[model samples]
Target chain A: MSRLSINQQTVKQLSLPELIRACTAVGVDAVGLWREPVAEYGLVRSAELFTSAGFSVTSLCRGGFFTAADPADRRRAIQDNRAAIDETAALGAPVLVLVAGGLPAGSRDLRGARAQVVDAIAELAPYAAERGVRLAIEPLHPMFTSDRCVVSTLAQSLDIAEQFPVAQVGVCVDTYHLWWDPDLDAGISRAGERIAAYQLADWTTPLPAGVLTGRGQIGDGCVDFPAFTEAVLATGYTGPIEVEIFNDELWKRDGAAVVAEIAARYPACVGTAS
Target chain B: MSRLSINQQTVKQLSLPELIRACTAVGVDAVGLWREPVAEYGLVRSAELFTSAGFSVTSLCRGGFFTAADPADRRRAIQDNRAAIDETAALGAPVLVLVAGGLPAGSRDLRGARAQVVDAIAELAPYAAERGVRLAIEPLHPMFTSDRCVVSTLAQSLDIAEQFPVAQVGVCVDTYHLWWDPDLDAGISRAGERIAAYQLADWTTPLPAGVLTGRGQIGDGCVDFPAFTEAVLATGYTGPIEVEIFNDELWKRDGAAVVAEIAARYPACVGTAS
Candidate 1:
């Protein structure tokens, strides 16, 4: 389980300490933490809690949402992302995942919104790099393109990432967000060293209303994990394969049980064989 | 209004006769029909009803779903598609919109599944052409990529359509599906003469649990109808612009009112302005 990191949101019911304990119990030494929980637990203390427990902080959960319509909202988003970068540095996380925000209220200008994301990133990437936190532009699924992230394809993520230095910016690869893409293999290959974070979550059907929390657990869906892992790994991406499912059903279950299920499925799915 | 067609599904609350009345009430003389509804109304009767009402059958609603796991099922699908082609010809509809089926039961081979679609289409295209029905491959939104339609982008639909003779096969340009695509303009331009049908539906958020019926009315959501219509019309497509929304809320409303709303929205959204 060396390469497997339990992204905290996958088992959101657990406290930071509890999450760390569970990961260690399952021999998963790596954990990806979200900014909210880290803020609640005290970022410095959280860092110490993970490091003291001999666990590696894989990556920070988020630091994007850059596409607000209003000028003040846009400014706030960039400033908040900058703070997330500082937190990423403090926590010793290598990357701060960026979920590009959706369109402004009732706006049809998708091209303009996407440009705003790039502008926000250009403003923040240098700050993030200076703080030693690489920004990972996470391209959410196209379903969420209009309301969530305009960056919907891995190619689009890489296109934005390629603009900056590789050390400062990279693309986040989440199978749940990207498995349907025919050009996924090419995107991964192209992402090479720019692949900062590699996340695992499956795409299940009958997506829940609002389509926020329907991500399937690894083996529960149709994603070919071995195929996906092989492609990502082939790109010299020796980073943690973070399990970051957002299923509403899973959240109702015991956090430990969920971790156990994820631990077992990882090796069988995108783990050792791949 | 001259270019506008009231797709039957847009006002599904109406019976075949009621739909014809509703359309004619609002001065819309063009329509696109679905097979199940046609079968319910008696295909010949439905054809006659539209013709007798002086309504032009713009295009038949569907006939694809080719990605079956079993060989026998594949054959059945092809046979059913052939019947649909005949129905289109009978209704004097020049196009048969094809919503390509999703992955077979418990399958992850998207490439293989897509190939199955091409194979099925190849077998049916000639028969469709002989019967004077052009099969329009309708690339659904990528959200339905796994369960509803594997063909999810305008470019991909064009790719499949280009393989067949332009008259025998073409692409369906639905605003709801293709609007999110960055390369949509390119795809529409490339599809020029190969554009068989143009469908309009707005993309609304807080998508319903099934996501099948979340499509908004013309001006109800984010779709810039004028832009979409301009792009499609630029391709020399002189066919009826069909309003094919699948909103649950719209379905609950009075069919005649919905038709009136659509009729009003058409001129403002995609008609005279475009």
Candidate 2:
């Protein structure tokens, strides 16, 4: 059976220890942890619990929020990312997903925001490489360009990755963010081995308030899962499929039920190995 | 004074006659017509109303929803576009805005959807060329990619336009739809003289239920209007600045009031001409 990873963001209602217990109880092969929860449980303690429970830590929730108005703010973001890298290494997570932050507060210059992101990533790349954890820049949907992320296109993400010589900087392809791109196939082919993590979620209409947290569950929206998964697989990424949803409604449901739904949805995204 | 063009879709609440009266009362210099309204008013009568009121027809509302499951359906779309072309000539609009339709009814194949769009445009381009009306393929926001239009990027729109001679096919650069593209400069520069129309509107959060009708008035959202206008101007486009908003809330207010707001908002988007 293909491995199933439950992203902590999908079940923020639970404590890190509770999330670990939930993962084990739900037949989840892995659990993806976010920084706050891990810090709350203490990274060492959380890692031990997962290892003891036979749950692999697929990936660290996130490490990038790079765009900032001032050089000092930018430096602070990089420093925080450095700590996140350390946390990922301690937790035994191979990858730390990077979400390029949007336009700096009150800034309308998208070009300037993008430049800050590149600079921040470049600064953190070396430190992350030294820590033995890869940084995967996740390109959010274009709608989030203003307040969430400026890197709205896969080509844009690949362009940023191309800037760094070391392969430590790669891309995290999340279905909800990228199913709309016209050049997706070409982008997947170009990414090839530079794909660090493959995350799945669905895109739906009537997106909720706090747009960041409205992601749909797999098979809950219009995205063609089988096709999207096949394209990413064509890039030769055989890593564990991580189910990441940010639905407010889902968080209110029973954690075990949500985990079961994700487990069922995981195979729909990627075909089950016979 | 800078020219103000009214797109009918923005004031979809009013009948064609009332819409023209609203425009004339507000001193709107131009108006964009749609097929249903024109057909409802009859082409000759619709042409006479605009002609008598001395309003320049900036562009036709739309003509492309090309992706279809069957060849017959595709043929029907082409024929409908021909009728739209005829109506554009009747109303004296120099440009016809084309929105490439979304995925074929049940199909989730994005690439295939785009290929169908190109073929439909190729088929319709020749007819529009002969009719003296330029086809302006408007690239919609990615949020609408599933149910509205498949051409989600300016680069993709221009790439399609490049397939034909400059005069026959072009793209409409609508600020509300394309304000978030990372490559806005390069895309606008590539559009250059092939830009058939330059439309304006703002992007707002808590988007309306009918996604197609939720555009904000200029200066109301996160879009950098001065920069957006400057980018279009840098492309050497000296066309009429069309203000189009599909807000149901705005439409519920007096059409004249809405027109006045657009007139007031226009200067903010494109500062007073020197």
lDDT of each: 0.89, 0.83
Clashing residue pairs found in predicted model 1: none
Question: How do the residues B179-205 of candidate 2 rate in per-residue lDDT, one tens digit apiece?
Answer: 998788889988899998988888776
What are the runs in model 1 whose C-alpha is more than 4 Å off?
A271-273, B271-273
Predicted model with the maximum TM-score: 1
True contacts kept of 1: 0.68
**What tens-digit string does per-residue lDDT give for candidate 1 at B79-191?**
99989999999999999999899999899899999999999999999898898889999999988988989998888888888998998999988898888887778989999
lDDT of 2 at B106: 63
Candidate that would win on DockQ:
1
DockQ of each: 0.78, 0.50
